[model samples]
Target chain A: DQQVKQNSPSLSVQEGRISILNCDYTNSMFDYFLWYKKYPAEGPTFLISISSIKDKNEDGRFTVFLNKSAKHLSLHIVPSQPGDSAVYFCAARAEGDSSYKLIFGSGTRLLVRP
Target chain B: NAGVTQTPKFRILKIGQSMTLQCTQDMNHNYMYWYRQDPGMGLKLIYYSVGAGITDKGEVPNGYNVSRSTTEDFPLRLELAAPSQTSVYFCASGAVSEQYFGPGTRLTVT
Candidate 1:
């Protein structure tokens, strides 16, 4: 089962525009969520994350909003840059899971058009 | 710090061949994991280790083997190569909340 889902396979936004990527999870037991950015031939890099108790977390131009009631989370990049263009994956972790097993979504390819 | 490092950035194996994908981390973190990513698909966990000598299988573990002999190394071994195994493999280390990934190793089984 795909515990985490990113329905949108691809997205495009003009440079300097707001870019939003959404993710949903079916397992309510997950308490930690993370977003990773990946470039071709490279491993994924952690972008930002938010705990289930928090509704929102922000770091500079990147902000993550978590809506526990809906089991949905979104990553928003304001003033999106061409450098931000890459595949983004959303991952979730269950509470009290010692192994740190993460369930990742298929990923969304975001292109920041100049 | 190297954080996480993977060897043999790229490899091509023939059917029935076997090879090991090496992974090591420098952060001294106790948790390490192996994941494989296929085209148009997200990374699927193959195995993970909580510490030295403690290992467990993840979502997709068949045809793959892992051993954590030290806190820093977690290597994945593929005994028999198959075309279905062609993909990119990633090794990550860190807490469950955040993970650091290696550059990745690309393997193609012909």
Candidate 2:
């Protein structure tokens, strides 16, 4: 069973516009959520993360919002750039797990058109 | 600094063959993990180690084994490889929240 799901397989947006990617989970035990950006032929790189205590976390052009009641989270990138075109993965981790084995979504391929 | 390194970036194996995927990290992290990603599928954890000489199974540890002999090396072994085991494997290491990933190793078993 896929605890985390990214319904959209791909998304396209124009440059200088906002690009939003959505993710949902069924496991309420997950307390920490993270987003990673992956380029072709490279490993996924950590972008930003938020603890369950906080509903929003922002880092430069990227921001993530979490709705615990809905078990949903969304990643927004403002003024999307061509360089931001890549696959984005949303991951969740449960508390008290020292190993931090993250459960990841299938991923959404984001294409920022110039 | 070669944060995390995986050797044999690409490999092709035949059924019943056995091999070890090498992973080494320079961050001196106490935690390490092995994950496999199939096409269009999210990564699934195979095994993990919190420290030297300690290893535990993760979500999908059925066809894999791992050992952590030192702080820097955590190698995954596949015994009697099968076609179903073919996938891209990744190695990660970290301390708190951020995990550094290595360029995945693509293994194809025919």
Candidate 3:
């Protein structure tokens, strides 16, 4: 079963515009969510994260919004730059006590057109 | 800290041949994982180890074997390589919330 899903396979946004990527999860047990960005030939790097307790978390130009009731989350990048072009993956963790197994989505390849 | 490191960034094997992919972490993390990614597909977990001497199978574990003799190293073995096993493999390490991934090893079976 696909616990996490990213319906959009690719996205394109003009540079200096906002880029939004969405993700959904079927498992309500997940409490922690994270977004990772990957460049060609490099490993994925953590971008931002949010806990179930908060609705939104922001770090500079990157912000993550979590809607627990909807079992959805999104990553927003303001003034998107060409350097931000890469594959973005959304992962969720359902911690059953101390054990938290991460479930990841297929990923969305974003292109910031200049 | 070189969070996670994988050896032989690229390799090619013939059908019926066998090989092992090496992975090491320097962060002293207790949790380690192996995942494979196919073209246009997300990563699928092959195996994972909570600590040395304790290993568990993940979503796709067939045609693969793993050993965790020491916390610093976790290696994956392919008994009889097949064309179907061609893909990019990733090794990750983490202690709690975040996972650090290696540069990935791309393998092809001819």
Give all candidates' CA lDDT scores.
0.94, 0.93, 0.91
State the lDDT at A93 in candidate 3: 80
Give a tens-digit lDDT track for model 1, residues A17-87: 99999999999899889999999888999999998889999999999999999999999999899999999
Spell out the clash pairs found in candidate 3: none
What tens digits encode model 3's per-residue C-alpha lDDT throughout A1-114? 889999999999999999999999999889899998989998888889999999999999999999988899999999899999999999888778525367789999999999
| DockQ of each model vs. true complex | 0.80, 0.69, 0.59
Off by over 4 Å in 3: none
Task: Say which prediction, candidate 1 or candidate 3, comes out ahead on DockQ.
Answer: 1
The digit string of per-residue lDDT tens for model 2 on A11-70 reads 999999999999999999998999989898788889999999999999999999999999
**Candidate 2 docking DockQ:** 0.69
Give the DockQ (C-alpha) for candidate 1.
0.80
Residue-level lDDT tens digits of model 1 in B1-110: 67899999999999999999999999999999999999988999999988999999999899999999899999999999999999999999988778899999999999
Q: Estimate TM-scores for all models.
A: 0.97, 0.98, 0.94
Residue A25 in model 1: shift from native, Å? Answer: 1.2
TM-score of chain B of each: 0.98, 0.97, 0.97
Better of 1 and 3 by lDDT: 1
For lDDT, the strongest prediction is 1
Per-model fnat list:
0.82, 0.60, 0.40
